[model samples]
Target: MNGLRVAVLSFAHEHAASYISLLHDRTDVELLTADPDFATAPADELRGRGFAARHGAAYVETYEEALAWGPDAVVICAENARHRDLVLAAAEVGAHVLCEKPLATRVEDAEAMVAACDAAGVVLMTAYPVRFSPEFATLRALVESGALGVVLGGTGTNNGKLPAGRSWFTDPELSGGGALADHVVHVADLLDALLGEEAVAVRAVTNRIVHGDDPRVRAETGGLVSITYAGGAEVTVDCSWSVPDGAPTWGGLTLQVVGTGGVVEIDPFGAHVGGVVAGGAEQAWLGLGENLDALMLEHFLGCVRTGSTPGPDGRAGLRSLRVVAAAQESVAAGGAVVRLTPSSAR
Candidate 1:
């Protein structure tokens, strides 16, 4: 059987590197990458033609050339605001897409991306690797099996160091609304999957106090988002870039679920070996668990091969984007509650 030809659209997001490295050696995938937008990216950043060469993947100079190569699938790791265009391009060429998270900076753009893929009859999977975590799957099972009855509310934290390496992360025009936009979608999508319901309202408070001294930090550095779901469950997310630079890892995600029966908490990054290096003073942790990104990629490839619909499809991406949009609006309104209509949720 012939392997699938996969093209990576851009390398703006850090995850693009990992995706390429993981897929490059797969016998079932022929890998190609393009990053025309990063032609002049800082040498310190892992992007442009050099990064692709390091991973032993074929590199192209432009999106047009990549799509023209006739790939079976495309992975979009462009900036938050650029997702719509890349997705539209892939859809036009009948290539399935796995778009990076937050989907888009605006609701209208996300909606348009979803609509275009649907019309083109191509699979549009949202790049939400967290959904593939075994820990989260266990939590969902407990909730569904009556082990945790009637989920009341929960708290989730997706804290990470400020992405200083990528200047675009702090630019609202390119990356959307800072921590709120960068972090909220993961937990929101998890909640949506667990409850199988839409968010009814959102209220949020954001501040620029964390990285405020940096002139380049135009977006909020920290935020707390309260989401009310249609199932009458509430989840509060701490979407903040609060992790200091000295941390052993980039960041971590932790969730605590409360229900009438009991409470359960999970730290996906908790299962790791921590120790000081022989010549270094700082401690480092080596993760000893499954790589969620690899699992997600396998799932995506499986869906493409079988012509099955992906879980957390384009609609799921739009749903999570809606939560982030509402959160941003709430922040703009000084923490006022922003309601979402049922029709809009659909």
Candidate 2:
């Protein structure tokens, strides 16, 4: 296949910068970026700070004009609320889509995005790049090969430092619910990839612990969520933004998966994986490949050429969002456990 031509729709999402860098550096891709109202203070500041790359790519005032650039696929990096409309538009225009996490704020819109892509007969992949992480892939292969025996449950944690530059992220409407909604779904998607099944229930506890000292923000700084998969496997997810600034250990994301035979632990920062051995714990660290964002771009382009389905497709994202929505609903309803509809087997 020839090189893949791609364009980005919005620059609101934090990961947009990373995507731009990936596209800029990849020789096989021709990248364009468009963002309406780029002169806004926030947008300009982001550009100055290097978050908005693809400065050479054509910029248009509206998305419709941007789509006319002849992109083979579109990367929808808009705000959570704008994802549904943007994805539908891309699919309608006959372009495959690579949308950021949390496909849409609502399940109904997510379903619509899925339907749009299905009707258009183009791919609609969600960015759950964690599945491609070396540690995660290794653990998944082990479990699938029965090296870990029957699976039981897993524990995942990602206590990232607070987002500093992006002020809009504090707005629940713009960024979605909070920490649990932001981070837990990534783990849910990863669990689905590893277990080859969907999550069936969610029971979560969320709280707004940060006063935003600025007195103007009210985003959550931390939370815990427990998810139950269809095969009876459970996952305890812990995420927060409380890690202190400039600390040597700025943030950490780790996972511990248990099986009938043994346990597997993954430390993403170091790309390390460890297993419990007879004497103690044996560990191995993986070499990084620039970062996950670059790897994700490569995977997407490869899938486009090979006619392969991206694992975290629109339906997969919808499944994760259903679990997230159930978790949010559970938290609102006094922490009551919520039962989710089984995902349609894809």
Candidate 3:
């Protein structure tokens, strides 16, 4: 463990697969160990070992063992509810953390995670790969630079295929509230980064229309959330798992920002090199422009090495968590407008 030792906290999240591979390949990282405690399959466990061994690391069964390896930083791929504890533990060890999205199941937990990291004086960065996306960064610039010309409002959509294999994603205790929780934070944080504002109030509603009466579909798979900011600018987000399995691709997002000058529409995945197929019955979508995850990791590890606080940090995570918490409250209250007050403000 010489230059930038790293550890993976869990294999509970699907992202761990790609993230481990990337870390193993990085020449700058001296060690990369993955604690594969919750790996679902033997194959997955083997894969984690392979990813670790390639970087001269040994598999660790427990998080404590992984920490004992003396990592400079840790990547948390734990469940949403487990985020708070993992963050607290990692920060306690004086390791900077880069955690997955939807920070935690509750706003209080997200707040506590931020406080713990702050108390430890360790960087607490959230994994918001969309912020590093080139197309998204370009759109953010357009919005912030007044190129959009006095923005009126915006319409955002992130309709993606259901996480078919991941049952914990819909579990209320693990993933928070489902569609609204999973999808809201991406665009919410993106807009906050672009506009330097957070929503003051929100009204949201959900429907269990997908999955056809399967009780495993315990969470809402389709939903609409309306967020209003202090400046009266509003955004209606179609944050749902409404995409059918028949879709050729994994689904995508679209953002339309209207302003006095004109409307700026950004489809980060719209520019595809592929063409229509099967008499236009199905179109092959190839929206693989950039590896935003790699870029985000690069930034996080650089901060770990330099001891600099990173962007889209725990505060950003907390703000998005508050917005989702408000949305959930609105849903429970029959789509009533729930006022948003960030936990940090309190």
Q: Evaluate all candidate structures by whole-model CA lDDT and list the values in order.
A: 0.91, 0.78, 0.81
Output the better candidate (2/3) by lDDT. 3
Give candidate 2 regions above 4 Å deviation: 37-44, 47-56, 211-214, 248-250, 271-290
Best candidate, TM-score-wise?
1
Q: What are the models' TM-scores? A: 0.97, 0.89, 0.90
Clashing pairs in 1: none
Tens digits of per-residue lDDT for model 3 on 1-346? 3468888877667677678778877887755555554565344234456555654555776788888777889999877878888899898889899999988998888888999999999999989887888877777788778887877789999888887656778788788878888888988887778767778999999998886487876789888999988777889999888888877677787888887767877777666767788898887877667777898999999888788878799999889888889999999999999997544541
Of the two candidates 1 and 3, the one with more favorable TM-score, higher being better, is: 1
lDDT for model 3, on a 0 to 1 scale? 0.81
Please give, for residues 82-196, the per-residue lDDT of candidate 1 as tens digits: 9999999999999999999989999999889988998999999998898899999999999999999999999999999998668889989999879999999999988888888
User: Quick one: best lDDT, which candidate?
Assistant: 1
Evaluation by lDDT, superior candidate among 1 and 3: 1
lDDT, residue 8, model 3: 80
